[model samples]
Target: MTRTTHDTHPVQGPEDVSGEATTSRWQQVRATGDAGLATAEYAVATVAAVGFAGLLIAILKSDEVRELLLGIIRGALSVG
Candidate 1:
């Protein structure tokens, strides 16, 4: 005995009716085009955040900024 298989929706070519083949191809591309978009965005945001944190750290470590912070702390701590 032998079994036969058939495809209910066969692949469409450019010659398909009403440009459906082009539309279908575009839909498929669009569907999968952004599969990693969110991950890529998160990675970019993470990198930007890390860069900003590094900048903040550098600024805070400056002598002038350190002195200003210390002065502010001293003023806050001193009794009037």
Candidate 2:
């Protein structure tokens, strides 16, 4: 048995309908990449701020919580 493939046309925009202009493919790719980078930067900043708030709450409420957090920081810095 043999299989057949079909070719499809891009969507017709206002200019395309009039046969006046066609869109570039590379521009679509660059726009998508830039949007992805912007979203990632926003996410990182949100997570760091939340972690700091958890540390602050522990400091205000529990001495044990404060000691555990201090140990985490000390471990990270290899200090007493």
Candidate 3:
């Protein structure tokens, strides 16, 4: 009796016809689900920055803060 051996490679499915495996529709969708994450973060940051600017404007419009800032500038300029 004689024994014989054979070399075999992995089987490629339909999706692997191009020599690379392709992602399924579900996988593609899952991968793209976070595509808008950066946009959403930017929008939130913009809104928060606008709110902060409004607050700063309201504070600077007050007479006390305006006078304090002006006095500081005058003192700094008057130094020799």
The best candidate in terms of lDDT: 1
Give each model a TM-score. Answer: 0.54, 0.34, 0.55
Off by over 4 Å in 1: 1-37
Clashes of 2: 0
Q: Which ten residues in a row have the lowest lDDT in candidate 2?
A: 1-10
Q: List the residue pairs that clash in candidate 3.
A: none
The lDDT values for all models are 0.73, 0.59, 0.67
Better of 1 and 2 by lDDT: 1
Q: Highest TM-score, which number?
A: 3
Rank candidates, lDDT, best first. Answer: 1, 3, 2
Least lDDT summed over 10 consecutive residues: which range in candidate 3? 1-10
lDDT of 1 by residue, 36-71 (tens): 458779999999999999999999999999999999
Q: Which of candidates 1 and 3 is the stronger one according to lDDT?
A: 1
lDDT of 3: 0.67
Q: For candidate 2, give the lDDT of residue 49.
A: 96
- The pairs that clash in candidate 1 are none
Count of clashes, each model? 0, 0, 0
Model 2 agreement with the true structure over 1-80: per-residue lDDT tens digits: 22223222234444443323333434444554533347778899889999999988867688788788888888999955
